[model samples]
Target: MVEVRHHYATVRGHRVFYREAGAREAPTLVLLHGYPSSSRMFRHLIPALADRFHVIAPDHLGFGNSDVPSVDAFPYTFDSLTDITEALLAQLDVTRYAVYVQDYGAPIGWRLALRTPDAITAVITQNGNAYEDGFVPEFWKPVWAYCENPGPQTEPAVRAALSLDAIRWQYLHGVDRPELVDPDTWAADHHEVSRPGNDLVQLALFRDYASNPPLYPQVHAYFRERQVPLLAVWGAGDEIFGPDGARAFARDLPDAEIHLVPGGGHFLLESHLDTVAGYVRGFLTAAASPA
Candidate 1:
Protein backbone atom coordinates (compact mmCIF):
# COMPACT_ATOMS: atom_id res chain seq x y z
CA MET A 1 0.00 0.00 0.00
CA VAL A 2 1.21 3.48 -0.81
CA GLU A 3 1.73 5.60 2.25
CA VAL A 4 0.73 9.24 2.20
CA ARG A 5 1.96 11.42 5.03
CA HIS A 6 0.96 14.91 6.10
CA HIS A 7 3.30 17.44 7.61
CA TYR A 8 3.99 21.14 8.09
CA ALA A 9 6.99 23.38 7.56
CA THR A 10 7.63 26.91 8.76
CA VAL A 11 8.81 28.87 5.74
CA ARG A 12 9.42 32.58 5.95
CA GLY A 13 7.71 32.74 9.35
CA HIS A 14 4.46 31.12 8.16
CA ARG A 15 3.21 27.60 8.72
CA VAL A 16 2.86 25.77 5.44
CA PHE A 17 0.96 22.49 5.29
CA TYR A 18 1.78 19.83 2.74
CA ARG A 19 1.00 16.20 1.93
CA GLU A 20 3.82 13.91 0.96
CA ALA A 21 3.92 10.37 -0.44
CA GLY A 22 6.08 7.83 -2.30
CA ALA A 23 9.75 6.89 -1.85
CA ARG A 24 12.21 9.67 -1.21
CA GLU A 25 14.51 8.44 -3.98
CA ALA A 26 11.80 8.52 -6.62
CA PRO A 27 11.21 11.31 -9.10
CA THR A 28 9.39 14.27 -7.53
CA LEU A 29 5.98 15.48 -8.65
CA VAL A 30 4.63 18.71 -7.16
CA LEU A 31 0.86 19.11 -7.17
CA LEU A 32 -0.39 22.70 -6.96
CA HIS A 33 -4.09 23.27 -6.34
CA GLY A 34 -6.65 25.83 -7.45
CA TYR A 35 -8.66 28.53 -5.70
CA PRO A 36 -10.73 28.02 -2.51
CA SER A 37 -9.08 24.59 -2.15
CA SER A 38 -5.90 23.31 -0.64
CA SER A 39 -3.66 20.26 -0.46
CA ARG A 40 -6.80 18.45 0.70
CA MET A 41 -7.94 18.41 -2.89
CA PHE A 42 -5.23 15.93 -3.80
CA ARG A 43 -5.84 13.46 -1.00
CA HIS A 44 -6.68 10.63 -3.38
CA LEU A 45 -4.19 11.51 -6.10
CA ILE A 46 -1.07 11.37 -3.89
CA PRO A 47 -1.40 7.65 -3.27
CA ALA A 48 -2.31 6.88 -6.85
CA LEU A 49 1.05 8.23 -8.05
CA ALA A 50 3.12 7.65 -4.93
CA ASP A 51 4.33 4.21 -5.93
CA ARG A 52 6.42 5.72 -8.73
CA PHE A 53 6.87 9.28 -7.61
CA HIS A 54 7.74 11.28 -4.55
CA VAL A 55 4.60 13.43 -4.52
CA ILE A 56 4.27 16.76 -2.69
CA ALA A 57 1.06 18.76 -2.51
CA PRO A 58 1.10 22.08 -0.65
CA ASP A 59 -1.72 24.27 0.58
CA HIS A 60 -0.91 27.86 -0.31
CA LEU A 61 -0.44 30.09 2.73
CA GLY A 62 -3.95 31.43 2.99
CA PHE A 63 -5.95 28.60 1.50
CA GLY A 64 -5.48 25.31 3.32
CA ASN A 65 -4.19 24.27 6.68
CA SER A 66 -1.42 26.81 6.19
CA ASP A 67 -1.10 30.04 8.09
CA VAL A 68 -3.63 32.65 7.06
CA PRO A 69 -1.80 35.88 7.72
CA SER A 70 -3.72 39.11 7.46
CA VAL A 71 -3.70 40.88 4.09
CA ASP A 72 -1.63 43.61 5.66
CA ALA A 73 0.89 41.06 6.84
CA PHE A 74 1.16 39.30 3.49
CA PRO A 75 1.10 40.79 0.02
CA TYR A 76 -1.28 38.03 -1.16
CA THR A 77 0.04 38.21 -4.70
CA PHE A 78 1.00 35.21 -6.84
CA ASP A 79 4.63 36.32 -6.53
CA SER A 80 4.48 36.16 -2.74
CA LEU A 81 2.82 32.76 -2.88
CA THR A 82 5.50 31.50 -5.27
CA ASP A 83 8.19 32.89 -3.03
CA ILE A 84 6.82 30.88 -0.13
CA THR A 85 6.48 27.75 -2.26
CA GLU A 86 10.03 28.14 -3.55
CA ALA A 87 11.33 28.60 -0.03
CA LEU A 88 9.40 25.57 1.14
CA LEU A 89 10.92 23.42 -1.61
CA ALA A 90 14.34 24.73 -0.76
CA GLN A 91 13.87 23.90 2.91
CA LEU A 92 12.71 20.44 1.89
CA ASP A 93 15.87 20.00 -0.26
CA VAL A 94 13.82 19.45 -3.42
CA THR A 95 15.71 20.63 -6.50
CA ARG A 96 14.11 19.12 -9.57
CA TYR A 97 10.53 18.01 -10.26
CA ALA A 98 7.53 17.98 -12.56
CA VAL A 99 4.58 20.22 -11.71
CA TYR A 100 0.86 19.52 -11.84
CA VAL A 101 -1.02 22.81 -11.89
CA GLN A 102 -4.70 23.75 -11.81
CA ASP A 103 -6.45 27.16 -11.69
CA TYR A 104 -4.60 29.39 -9.21
CA GLY A 105 -1.74 26.95 -9.26
CA ALA A 106 -1.09 27.78 -12.90
CA PRO A 107 0.36 31.23 -12.28
CA ILE A 108 2.45 29.97 -9.40
CA GLY A 109 3.76 27.07 -11.47
CA TRP A 110 4.50 29.37 -14.39
CA ARG A 111 6.42 31.77 -12.17
CA LEU A 112 8.43 28.84 -10.84
CA ALA A 113 9.10 27.65 -14.37
CA LEU A 114 10.24 31.10 -15.42
CA ARG A 115 12.48 31.43 -12.42
CA THR A 116 14.23 28.09 -12.81
CA PRO A 117 13.46 26.67 -16.19
CA ASP A 118 16.06 23.96 -15.90
CA ALA A 119 14.58 22.43 -12.77
CA ILE A 120 11.17 21.72 -14.28
CA THR A 121 11.02 18.37 -16.07
CA ALA A 122 7.46 18.48 -17.28
CA VAL A 123 4.16 20.25 -16.71
CA ILE A 124 0.69 18.74 -16.36
CA THR A 125 -2.00 21.37 -16.41
CA GLN A 126 -5.61 20.58 -15.55
CA ASN A 127 -7.69 23.63 -16.39
CA GLY A 128 -4.65 25.77 -15.47
CA ASN A 129 -4.72 28.53 -18.02
CA ALA A 130 -2.00 30.96 -19.22
CA TYR A 131 -3.47 32.13 -22.50
CA GLU A 132 -5.90 34.91 -23.32
CA ASP A 133 -7.94 32.42 -25.28
CA GLY A 134 -8.47 30.53 -22.06
CA PHE A 135 -10.61 33.24 -20.50
CA VAL A 136 -14.35 32.57 -20.56
CA PRO A 137 -15.49 36.18 -20.73
CA GLU A 138 -19.00 35.49 -19.52
CA PHE A 139 -17.79 33.90 -16.31
CA TRP A 140 -14.91 36.33 -15.93
CA LYS A 141 -16.81 39.51 -16.67
CA PRO A 142 -17.24 40.48 -13.05
CA VAL A 143 -13.70 39.46 -12.18
CA TRP A 144 -12.33 41.53 -15.03
CA ALA A 145 -14.37 44.50 -13.98
CA TYR A 146 -13.10 44.20 -10.45
CA CYS A 147 -9.53 43.72 -11.62
CA GLU A 148 -9.77 46.86 -13.68
CA ASN A 149 -11.32 48.85 -10.88
CA PRO A 150 -11.76 47.66 -7.31
CA GLY A 151 -14.57 49.51 -5.53
CA PRO A 152 -18.01 49.03 -4.02
CA GLN A 153 -19.69 48.47 -7.39
CA THR A 154 -17.32 45.74 -8.54
CA GLU A 155 -16.38 44.42 -5.11
CA PRO A 156 -19.92 43.20 -4.42
CA ALA A 157 -19.91 40.79 -7.37
CA VAL A 158 -16.45 39.51 -6.55
CA ARG A 159 -17.42 39.03 -2.92
CA ALA A 160 -20.55 37.12 -3.88
CA ALA A 161 -18.47 34.82 -6.02
CA LEU A 162 -16.69 33.75 -2.86
CA SER A 163 -19.92 32.84 -1.10
CA LEU A 164 -20.59 29.21 -0.19
CA ASP A 165 -23.44 29.03 -2.69
CA ALA A 166 -21.20 30.30 -5.49
CA ILE A 167 -18.46 27.89 -4.46
CA ARG A 168 -20.97 25.02 -4.56
CA TRP A 169 -22.15 26.06 -8.00
CA GLN A 170 -18.58 26.05 -9.31
CA TYR A 171 -18.22 22.45 -8.27
CA LEU A 172 -21.52 21.25 -9.73
CA HIS A 173 -22.42 23.51 -12.63
CA GLY A 174 -20.68 21.83 -15.54
CA VAL A 175 -20.17 18.47 -13.92
CA ASP A 176 -22.17 15.76 -15.66
CA ARG A 177 -22.21 13.57 -12.57
CA PRO A 178 -22.66 16.00 -9.73
CA GLU A 179 -23.86 13.09 -7.64
CA LEU A 180 -20.38 11.64 -7.75
CA VAL A 181 -18.74 14.81 -6.43
CA ASP A 182 -18.04 14.66 -2.72
CA PRO A 183 -19.91 17.26 -0.69
CA ASP A 184 -16.96 17.61 1.65
CA THR A 185 -14.96 19.34 -1.06
CA TRP A 186 -17.02 22.50 -1.14
CA ALA A 187 -18.11 22.23 2.49
CA ALA A 188 -14.52 22.24 3.68
CA ASP A 189 -13.72 25.05 1.27
CA HIS A 190 -16.63 27.09 2.62
CA HIS A 191 -15.41 26.52 6.13
CA GLU A 192 -12.02 27.94 5.22
CA VAL A 193 -13.46 30.91 3.35
CA SER A 194 -15.75 31.56 6.28
CA ARG A 195 -12.73 32.40 8.40
CA PRO A 196 -12.96 35.97 9.72
CA GLY A 197 -10.49 37.63 7.33
CA ASN A 198 -10.23 35.02 4.60
CA ASP A 199 -12.69 36.81 2.36
CA LEU A 200 -10.43 39.82 2.06
CA VAL A 201 -7.49 37.56 1.36
CA GLN A 202 -9.39 35.98 -1.53
CA LEU A 203 -10.44 39.35 -2.83
CA ALA A 204 -6.86 40.53 -2.74
CA LEU A 205 -5.84 37.56 -4.81
CA PHE A 206 -8.71 38.24 -7.21
CA ARG A 207 -7.44 41.75 -7.76
CA ASP A 208 -3.91 40.45 -8.18
CA TYR A 209 -5.13 38.10 -10.90
CA ALA A 210 -5.02 41.11 -13.14
CA SER A 211 -1.26 40.76 -12.98
CA ASN A 212 -1.26 37.27 -14.57
CA PRO A 213 -2.63 37.86 -18.07
CA PRO A 214 0.04 40.38 -18.94
CA LEU A 215 2.69 37.73 -18.34
CA TYR A 216 1.20 35.27 -20.84
CA PRO A 217 3.49 36.39 -23.59
CA GLN A 218 6.52 35.76 -21.44
CA VAL A 219 5.16 32.31 -20.49
CA HIS A 220 4.66 31.49 -24.14
CA ALA A 221 8.16 32.69 -24.89
CA TYR A 222 9.51 30.42 -22.17
CA PHE A 223 7.57 27.50 -23.65
CA ARG A 224 9.03 28.10 -27.09
CA GLU A 225 12.54 28.61 -25.82
CA ARG A 226 12.68 25.71 -23.41
CA GLN A 227 10.51 23.24 -25.28
CA VAL A 228 9.69 21.66 -21.94
CA PRO A 229 7.39 18.66 -22.17
CA LEU A 230 3.78 19.58 -21.41
CA LEU A 231 0.56 17.65 -20.98
CA ALA A 232 -2.74 19.49 -20.74
CA VAL A 233 -5.61 17.27 -19.59
CA TRP A 234 -8.42 19.72 -19.20
CA GLY A 235 -12.06 19.46 -18.27
CA ALA A 236 -13.60 20.54 -21.57
CA GLY A 237 -16.85 21.55 -19.95
CA ASP A 238 -15.17 23.91 -17.50
CA GLU A 239 -17.24 27.09 -17.56
CA ILE A 240 -14.53 29.33 -16.18
CA PHE A 241 -11.67 28.17 -18.37
CA GLY A 242 -12.71 26.40 -21.53
CA PRO A 243 -10.93 23.71 -23.53
CA ASP A 244 -9.43 26.36 -25.75
CA GLY A 245 -6.97 27.07 -22.96
CA ALA A 246 -5.80 23.46 -23.16
CA ARG A 247 -5.46 23.74 -26.91
CA ALA A 248 -3.44 26.94 -26.63
CA PHE A 249 -0.48 25.01 -25.24
CA ALA A 250 -0.06 23.36 -28.61
CA ARG A 251 0.60 26.67 -30.30
CA ASP A 252 3.84 27.05 -28.37
CA LEU A 253 4.97 23.52 -27.61
CA PRO A 254 3.95 21.67 -30.71
CA ASP A 255 4.84 18.39 -29.04
CA ALA A 256 2.58 19.04 -26.05
CA GLU A 257 0.09 16.29 -25.26
CA ILE A 258 -3.39 17.74 -24.93
CA HIS A 259 -6.56 15.97 -23.85
CA LEU A 260 -9.98 17.47 -23.21
CA VAL A 261 -12.18 15.18 -21.19
CA PRO A 262 -15.77 15.58 -22.27
CA GLY A 263 -18.37 16.11 -19.55
CA GLY A 264 -15.61 16.97 -17.11
CA GLY A 265 -16.06 20.31 -15.37
CA HIS A 266 -13.69 22.67 -13.56
CA PHE A 267 -12.95 20.25 -10.75
CA LEU A 268 -12.39 17.22 -12.95
CA LEU A 269 -10.52 15.13 -10.41
CA GLU A 270 -13.57 14.94 -8.15
CA SER A 271 -15.44 12.91 -10.74
CA HIS A 272 -12.75 11.50 -13.05
CA LEU A 273 -9.98 10.45 -10.73
CA ASP A 274 -9.08 7.21 -12.45
CA THR A 275 -8.77 8.75 -15.90
CA VAL A 276 -6.55 11.63 -14.71
CA ALA A 277 -4.39 9.36 -12.60
CA GLY A 278 -3.82 7.04 -15.54
CA TYR A 279 -2.83 9.91 -17.76
CA VAL A 280 -0.48 11.36 -15.16
CA ARG A 281 1.22 8.03 -14.52
CA GLY A 282 1.81 7.32 -18.20
CA PHE A 283 2.93 10.83 -19.08
CA LEU A 284 5.27 11.31 -16.14
CA THR A 285 6.83 7.91 -16.78
CA ALA A 286 7.56 8.76 -20.41
CA ALA A 287 8.66 12.26 -19.49
CA ALA A 288 11.27 10.94 -17.11
CA SER A 289 12.54 8.33 -19.53
CA PRO A 290 15.88 8.89 -21.27
CA ALA A 291 15.36 10.58 -24.62
Candidate 2:
Protein backbone atom coordinates (compact mmCIF):
# COMPACT_ATOMS: atom_id res chain seq x y z
CA MET A 1 0.00 0.00 0.00
CA VAL A 2 1.24 3.47 -0.84
CA GLU A 3 1.70 5.69 2.20
CA VAL A 4 0.22 9.16 2.38
CA ARG A 5 1.91 11.72 4.60
CA HIS A 6 0.19 14.75 6.12
CA HIS A 7 1.94 18.09 6.46
CA TYR A 8 1.27 21.75 7.05
CA ALA A 9 2.78 24.79 5.38
CA THR A 10 2.61 28.35 6.64
CA VAL A 11 1.07 30.45 3.88
CA ARG A 12 0.24 34.08 4.50
CA GLY A 13 0.35 33.49 8.27
CA HIS A 14 -2.14 30.61 8.12
CA ARG A 15 -1.34 26.92 8.60
CA VAL A 16 -2.40 25.27 5.37
CA PHE A 17 -2.68 21.49 5.76
CA TYR A 18 -2.15 19.07 2.88
CA ARG A 19 -1.77 15.36 2.11
CA GLU A 20 1.22 14.22 0.07
CA ALA A 21 2.23 10.90 -1.43
CA GLY A 22 4.37 9.27 -4.13
CA ALA A 23 8.01 9.93 -5.00
CA ARG A 24 9.22 13.51 -5.27
CA GLU A 25 10.70 12.81 -8.70
CA ALA A 26 7.38 11.72 -10.15
CA PRO A 27 5.26 14.10 -12.18
CA THR A 28 3.02 16.07 -9.83
CA LEU A 29 -0.76 15.99 -9.66
CA VAL A 30 -2.43 18.58 -7.44
CA LEU A 31 -5.87 17.74 -6.13
CA LEU A 32 -8.16 20.61 -5.11
CA HIS A 33 -11.38 19.66 -3.33
CA GLY A 34 -14.83 21.22 -3.23
CA TYR A 35 -17.01 22.95 -0.63
CA PRO A 36 -17.54 21.74 2.94
CA SER A 37 -14.80 19.19 2.24
CA SER A 38 -11.01 19.33 2.47
CA SER A 39 -7.95 17.38 1.45
CA ARG A 40 -9.62 14.52 3.30
CA MET A 41 -11.73 14.03 0.19
CA PHE A 42 -8.69 12.67 -1.64
CA ARG A 43 -7.73 10.09 0.98
CA HIS A 44 -8.38 7.19 -1.36
CA LEU A 45 -7.42 8.83 -4.62
CA ILE A 46 -4.05 9.97 -3.30
CA PRO A 47 -2.86 6.46 -2.59
CA ALA A 48 -4.30 5.15 -5.81
CA LEU A 49 -2.35 7.60 -7.93
CA ALA A 50 0.70 7.92 -5.70
CA ASP A 51 2.41 5.08 -7.55
CA ARG A 52 2.33 6.98 -10.83
CA PHE A 53 2.26 10.62 -9.75
CA HIS A 54 3.20 12.74 -6.79
CA VAL A 55 -0.12 13.87 -5.30
CA ILE A 56 -0.72 17.05 -3.33
CA ALA A 57 -4.11 17.64 -1.80
CA PRO A 58 -4.56 20.75 0.29
CA ASP A 59 -7.24 22.03 2.63
CA HIS A 60 -8.03 25.62 1.81
CA LEU A 61 -8.27 28.07 4.68
CA GLY A 62 -11.57 27.89 6.59
CA PHE A 63 -12.05 24.24 5.57
CA GLY A 64 -10.63 20.83 6.53
CA ASN A 65 -7.58 20.72 8.78
CA SER A 66 -6.43 24.17 7.70
CA ASP A 67 -6.52 27.14 10.04
CA VAL A 68 -10.08 28.30 10.46
CA PRO A 69 -9.72 32.03 10.71
CA SER A 70 -12.81 33.93 11.73
CA VAL A 71 -14.87 35.22 8.83
CA ASP A 72 -13.78 38.75 9.61
CA ALA A 73 -10.12 37.76 9.64
CA PHE A 74 -10.13 36.22 6.15
CA PRO A 75 -11.87 37.33 2.98
CA TYR A 76 -13.07 33.74 2.12
CA THR A 77 -13.22 34.64 -1.54
CA PHE A 78 -12.10 32.17 -4.22
CA ASP A 79 -9.38 34.60 -5.27
CA SER A 80 -7.92 34.65 -1.77
CA LEU A 81 -8.16 30.88 -1.54
CA THR A 82 -6.33 30.61 -4.86
CA ASP A 83 -3.63 32.95 -3.60
CA ILE A 84 -3.04 30.75 -0.57
CA THR A 85 -2.96 27.61 -2.75
CA GLU A 86 -0.59 29.19 -5.26
CA ALA A 87 1.71 30.35 -2.48
CA LEU A 88 1.67 26.93 -0.88
CA LEU A 89 2.67 25.39 -4.23
CA ALA A 90 5.51 27.87 -4.63
CA GLN A 91 6.67 27.16 -1.10
CA LEU A 92 6.71 23.45 -1.95
CA ASP A 93 8.78 24.18 -5.07
CA VAL A 94 5.99 22.87 -7.33
CA THR A 95 6.53 24.89 -10.52
CA ARG A 96 4.52 22.73 -12.94
CA TYR A 97 1.79 20.15 -12.27
CA ALA A 98 -1.49 18.79 -13.52
CA VAL A 99 -4.50 19.79 -11.39
CA TYR A 100 -7.53 17.70 -10.41
CA VAL A 101 -10.39 20.00 -9.49
CA GLN A 102 -13.91 19.58 -8.15
CA ASP A 103 -16.64 22.06 -7.21
CA TYR A 104 -15.01 25.09 -5.54
CA GLY A 105 -11.68 23.70 -6.71
CA ALA A 106 -12.76 24.51 -10.26
CA PRO A 107 -12.63 28.25 -9.66
CA ILE A 108 -9.34 28.03 -7.78
CA GLY A 109 -7.74 25.77 -10.40
CA TRP A 110 -8.97 27.98 -13.25
CA ARG A 111 -7.55 31.05 -11.52
CA LEU A 112 -4.20 29.32 -11.16
CA ALA A 113 -4.23 28.32 -14.82
CA LEU A 114 -5.06 31.87 -15.83
CA ARG A 115 -2.34 33.33 -13.62
CA THR A 116 0.36 30.95 -14.80
CA PRO A 117 -0.70 29.28 -17.99
CA ASP A 118 2.77 27.91 -18.54
CA ALA A 119 2.80 26.20 -15.14
CA ILE A 120 -0.17 23.98 -15.93
CA THR A 121 0.71 20.69 -17.67
CA ALA A 122 -2.84 19.33 -17.97
CA VAL A 123 -6.29 19.67 -16.42
CA ILE A 124 -8.64 17.12 -14.91
CA THR A 125 -12.08 18.13 -13.70
CA GLN A 126 -14.66 16.05 -11.86
CA ASN A 127 -17.90 17.90 -11.40
CA GLY A 128 -15.87 21.13 -11.78
CA ASN A 129 -17.58 23.76 -13.85
CA ALA A 130 -16.34 26.64 -16.03
CA TYR A 131 -19.28 27.70 -18.18
CA GLU A 132 -22.62 29.20 -17.22
CA ASP A 133 -24.24 26.27 -19.03
CA GLY A 134 -23.04 24.00 -16.22
CA PHE A 135 -25.23 25.57 -13.56
CA VAL A 136 -28.34 23.64 -12.59
CA PRO A 137 -30.81 26.47 -12.09
CA GLU A 138 -32.84 24.61 -9.48
CA PHE A 139 -29.78 23.70 -7.43
CA TRP A 140 -28.26 27.15 -7.79
CA LYS A 141 -31.41 29.26 -7.51
CA PRO A 142 -31.04 30.09 -3.82
CA VAL A 143 -27.30 30.62 -4.20
CA TRP A 144 -27.84 32.94 -7.17
CA ALA A 145 -30.46 34.85 -5.19
CA TYR A 146 -28.15 35.25 -2.22
CA CYS A 147 -25.26 36.31 -4.44
CA GLU A 148 -27.39 39.01 -6.03
CA ASN A 149 -28.84 40.42 -2.81
CA PRO A 150 -26.74 39.41 0.15
CA GLY A 151 -28.76 40.99 2.91
CA PRO A 152 -30.32 39.87 6.19
CA GLN A 153 -33.25 38.38 4.27
CA THR A 154 -31.10 36.33 1.90
CA GLU A 155 -28.54 35.39 4.54
CA PRO A 156 -30.86 33.05 6.40
CA ALA A 157 -31.61 30.98 3.34
CA VAL A 158 -27.96 30.67 2.46
CA ARG A 159 -27.14 29.72 6.05
CA ALA A 160 -29.82 27.08 6.04
CA ALA A 161 -28.47 25.72 2.80
CA LEU A 162 -25.18 25.05 4.55
CA SER A 163 -26.82 23.06 7.31
CA LEU A 164 -25.82 19.47 8.07
CA ASP A 165 -28.90 18.07 6.37
CA ALA A 166 -28.05 19.87 3.18
CA ILE A 167 -24.49 18.64 3.41
CA ARG A 168 -25.72 15.06 3.72
CA TRP A 169 -28.01 15.52 0.75
CA GLN A 170 -25.09 16.61 -1.39
CA TYR A 171 -23.39 13.29 -0.69
CA LEU A 172 -26.23 10.81 -1.25
CA HIS A 173 -28.67 12.64 -3.51
CA GLY A 174 -27.74 11.17 -6.92
CA VAL A 175 -25.73 8.12 -6.03
CA ASP A 176 -27.03 4.77 -7.25
CA ARG A 177 -25.56 3.05 -4.22
CA PRO A 178 -25.82 5.42 -1.31
CA GLU A 179 -24.61 2.72 1.06
CA LEU A 180 -21.27 2.66 -0.75
CA VAL A 181 -20.62 6.25 0.24
CA ASP A 182 -18.99 6.56 3.62
CA PRO A 183 -21.14 8.43 6.12
CA ASP A 184 -17.99 9.83 7.71
CA THR A 185 -17.58 12.15 4.70
CA TRP A 186 -20.49 14.39 5.55
CA ALA A 187 -20.04 13.86 9.29
CA ALA A 188 -16.55 15.32 9.14
CA ASP A 189 -17.78 18.17 6.97
CA HIS A 190 -20.59 18.91 9.43
CA HIS A 191 -18.08 19.01 12.25
CA GLU A 192 -16.05 21.67 10.41
CA VAL A 193 -19.06 23.73 9.45
CA SER A 194 -20.41 23.52 12.98
CA ARG A 195 -17.27 25.14 14.33
CA PRO A 196 -17.80 28.54 15.86
CA GLY A 197 -17.89 31.30 13.19
CA ASN A 198 -17.24 28.84 10.34
CA ASP A 199 -20.83 29.23 9.19
CA LEU A 200 -20.19 32.86 8.36
CA VAL A 201 -17.06 31.91 6.46
CA GLN A 202 -19.01 29.46 4.31
CA LEU A 203 -21.74 31.99 3.75
CA ALA A 204 -19.20 34.54 2.62
CA LEU A 205 -17.81 32.04 0.09
CA PHE A 206 -21.28 31.32 -1.27
CA ARG A 207 -21.71 35.02 -1.92
CA ASP A 208 -18.26 35.39 -3.42
CA TYR A 209 -18.98 32.54 -5.85
CA ALA A 210 -20.77 35.20 -7.87
CA SER A 211 -17.31 36.49 -8.71
CA ASN A 212 -16.52 33.30 -10.65
CA PRO A 213 -19.26 33.49 -13.31
CA PRO A 214 -17.94 36.81 -14.49
CA LEU A 215 -14.60 35.11 -15.19
CA TYR A 216 -16.11 32.30 -17.29
CA PRO A 217 -15.44 34.04 -20.56
CA GLN A 218 -11.83 34.38 -19.61
CA VAL A 219 -11.64 30.68 -18.75
CA HIS A 220 -13.18 29.80 -22.08
CA ALA A 221 -10.71 32.00 -23.86
CA TYR A 222 -7.86 30.34 -21.99
CA PHE A 223 -9.15 26.94 -23.03
CA ARG A 224 -9.23 27.97 -26.68
CA GLU A 225 -5.81 29.55 -26.63
CA ARG A 226 -3.89 27.01 -24.56
CA GLN A 227 -5.66 23.94 -25.85
CA VAL A 228 -4.51 22.21 -22.70
CA PRO A 229 -5.01 18.47 -22.46
CA LEU A 230 -8.24 18.21 -20.42
CA LEU A 231 -10.12 15.25 -19.04
CA ALA A 232 -13.60 16.05 -17.74
CA VAL A 233 -15.00 13.11 -15.82
CA TRP A 234 -18.27 14.07 -14.18
CA GLY A 235 -21.16 12.50 -12.37
CA ALA A 236 -24.02 12.59 -14.83
CA GLY A 237 -26.54 12.60 -12.02
CA ASP A 238 -24.87 15.43 -10.15
CA GLU A 239 -27.62 17.84 -9.28
CA ILE A 240 -25.28 20.75 -8.85
CA PHE A 241 -23.10 20.59 -11.94
CA GLY A 242 -24.82 18.02 -14.19
CA PRO A 243 -23.39 16.31 -17.29
CA ASP A 244 -23.45 19.43 -19.41
CA GLY A 245 -20.55 20.81 -17.43
CA ALA A 246 -18.35 17.93 -18.58
CA ARG A 247 -19.53 18.18 -22.17
CA ALA A 248 -19.00 21.95 -22.15
CA PHE A 249 -15.25 21.41 -22.09
CA ALA A 250 -15.35 19.90 -25.55
CA ARG A 251 -16.72 23.12 -26.95
CA ASP A 252 -13.59 25.04 -25.94
CA LEU A 253 -10.99 22.29 -26.11
CA PRO A 254 -12.15 20.12 -28.95
CA ASP A 255 -9.82 17.28 -28.11
CA ALA A 256 -10.82 17.23 -24.44
CA GLU A 257 -11.99 13.88 -23.06
CA ILE A 258 -15.45 13.86 -21.46
CA HIS A 259 -16.96 11.01 -19.47
CA LEU A 260 -20.16 11.07 -17.41
CA VAL A 261 -20.63 8.27 -14.92
CA PRO A 262 -24.18 7.00 -14.72
CA GLY A 263 -25.82 7.63 -11.34
CA GLY A 264 -22.60 9.01 -9.95
CA GLY A 265 -23.44 11.90 -7.68
CA HIS A 266 -21.74 15.18 -6.83
CA PHE A 267 -19.01 13.46 -4.87
CA LEU A 268 -18.19 11.04 -7.67
CA LEU A 269 -15.14 9.65 -5.96
CA GLU A 270 -17.20 8.30 -3.12
CA SER A 271 -19.18 5.96 -5.36
CA HIS A 272 -16.85 5.45 -8.33
CA LEU A 273 -13.35 5.55 -7.03
CA ASP A 274 -11.77 2.84 -9.16
CA THR A 275 -13.47 4.03 -12.34
CA VAL A 276 -12.26 7.58 -11.90
CA ALA A 277 -8.81 6.41 -10.92
CA GLY A 278 -8.52 4.24 -14.01
CA TYR A 279 -9.44 7.11 -16.26
CA VAL A 280 -7.06 9.47 -14.51
CA ARG A 281 -4.14 7.05 -14.64
CA GLY A 282 -4.58 6.54 -18.37
CA PHE A 283 -5.16 10.21 -19.18
CA LEU A 284 -2.23 11.52 -17.17
CA THR A 285 0.10 8.85 -18.49
CA ALA A 286 -0.45 10.10 -22.00
CA ALA A 287 -0.69 13.78 -21.11
CA ALA A 288 2.55 13.72 -19.14
CA SER A 289 4.50 11.94 -21.86
CA PRO A 290 7.20 13.87 -23.76
CA ALA A 291 6.03 15.12 -27.13
lDDT of 1 by residue, 16-41 (tens): 99999999899999999999899888
Off by over 4 Å in 2: none
Output the lDDT of residue 27, model 1. Answer: 97
Per-candidate TM equals: 0.99, 0.99
Q: Which residue pairs collide, candidate 1? A: none
CA-lDDT, candidates in order: 0.94, 0.94
| TM-score between candidate 1 and the true structure | 0.99
How high is the lDDT of residue 140 in model 1? 96
